[model samples]
Target: MGTTGVRTDRLGLLLAQFDQARETAQVRLTGLSDAEYLWEPVDGCWSIRPREEAVTPRAYGPGAWVIDKGAPEIPASEYAEVARQAAGGMSVAKIAEDWSVSVERVEEVLAHTGEPEPDVVPVTTIAWRLGHLHSGFAGQWEWSFGERRREPRLMVDFAPSADLALERFWAELDRWRESLGAVTEEQLDTVGFSQYPYGSDPDDPFISVLFGANLELIHHMAEIAVLRDLWRARFQLPAH
Candidate 1:
């Protein structure tokens, strides 16, 4: 079946619906507790449960702290380290490549670390946060296109508290939506978009990748929400 046969009007409407799902996904975890964050709906299954210590996507947002000894969460220092690297024109791709991380990974760090506070900051504090973001999205996007690749050998590993991960994920989607505002419809049909590493195909139109992204985005959002609900119930927390 020819892909171009899809109606543009329908596509827009579909995207809008996907947008709603995305919004709902983000809002689903507005109020949750630490215990609830770890609550599992079923036995032996893990949810995207956000923990204070849980690392979500490749990012570290506000309130992240690292003050332990033998420790990395030294915010001022890490900030300076990242800042110096950035000011020295350290691009995400370069960072990823240098650290044996994928380009998508670098992007995740940039998204989560947020300019490294313009100076050195704690390396340990947001380490998990940064790793999760990079790994999850990179893995997910790869899965979306059935073009999965070798795993990224990142510099660190971090998992967030389920709630925090959900929150950060929601925020990341918001970031995507904001960024999409700058994407043109013409661009949607344009060829060879590099934004999606494994998802975008050179032979396919932009709309095709857009369609795939639409589905992937909504699906992940729903998966996350369900994970939240399941986690809450595992702890006997009220779903309402």
Candidate 2:
């Protein structure tokens, strides 16, 4: 096969996978009620919440609702370990290895300077998972096809309800599909075809970015589906 044929095949496979995942997600989302969408089955599950109720250091959205996102503060006990490690002359790398965390995490802990770890993936609700998928698509679309100037957090408005969120989510999915549809054979092979700032999109071939995006959709949608199942079974009697 020629180069053009290979590109067409690759792009075709990506679009097909995306479409399938979208369809599956839509099916899972059918008749999703606001209660189910916002249900927090476990303690500290991240989900859409009123702006005033948001616990994250930074929440995304301009509306009454916001997504619980952003780096969580380290706990006081965890920070005490950092202090202990530091006083013991442990290198940042050694501390990170001992904690099974990244060196950057160790640095952040050290730089935190004894601040208490704030009470904080937190099993996310359907709403939070959907918001994440929406952000991924919308962010990629904005950077790759739109003005390419604004960050996605600034570009998206968090939906306040299940219906509205689904509406906006579908719209972003369409935009993403349209953008992918326009990629040329040469563009797929070109590095930095997608200038999305959040990930390594700008450093990799467009095809690699496409595959990653598809993977995100597939996995997140499956999670949403499983959440829906758990929600439905929450009130059911267990089998003996």
Candidate 3:
């Protein structure tokens, strides 16, 4: 195949992962409210507050917003931990399909997946991981694709509340998806993002942006899954 064919193949995989992750996270959010959404593991952990003043972005270098009122520096690497490690596998399109099951087969969600559980140590709620991913992903994307991201470093607010944050973040993501669907190869070739500090462009490629979104979605979705299991253990809510 030609270069355009190769790029199109990759973009198709990325968008699928993006949408799949979005659906999984939304499933986690069902029936939850604002007050229930904000609950975290401890006092110092991060959260998206209804008011802007509640959580500062963090002060470090130019364009670096304060995270907490006077919180300490948080490295981009710190986010990678909360962000889901790869679930292990190539992008789905690359995987062999079962003709019998069909492409539409979906898994029913459960409180636990039998993966080893996180230790009982404390930090923040499941939603905080999503917020951290939003900031890190946006900052990295801006630096690479859009412009030179000023430092100490920076983060973006996906939402004021956990209930809304994922939904709001999805809106931005939907635009990106539209860009992928609508932009001609000529446009994408000329219009590129900075994505600096992360990797070299053209060489590094825009697929990384989609990959970041995929990673963020899976991580938070898993965190919510664990939380659901915990909630079940505590309250014994019926599987509905």
- Each prediction's total of clashing residue pairs, residues at least 3 apart in sequence or on different chains, is 36, 1, 19
- Order the candidate numbers by lDDT, best to worst: 2, 3, 1
Higher-TM-score candidate of 1 and 3: 3
17-110: candidate 3 lDDT, tens digit per residue? 7777777766666876555556664566555444434554442222222233233322233323212211333222211131112222211111
lDDT score, candidate 3? 0.49
What TM-score against the true fold does each predicted structure earn?
Answer: 0.44, 0.77, 0.53
Question: Residue 116 in model 3: shift from native, Å?
Answer: 20
Candidate 2 deviant stretches above 4 angstroms: 1-8, 72-120
Q: Scored by CA lDDT, what does every candidate get?
A: 0.46, 0.81, 0.49
Query: What lDDT does candidate 3 reach at residue 164?
Result: 68
lDDT (10s digit) by residue, model 1, range 174-220? 55555555556776677664234432244356567666657665655
Winner by TM-score: 2
> Candidates 2 and 3: which is better by TM-score?
2
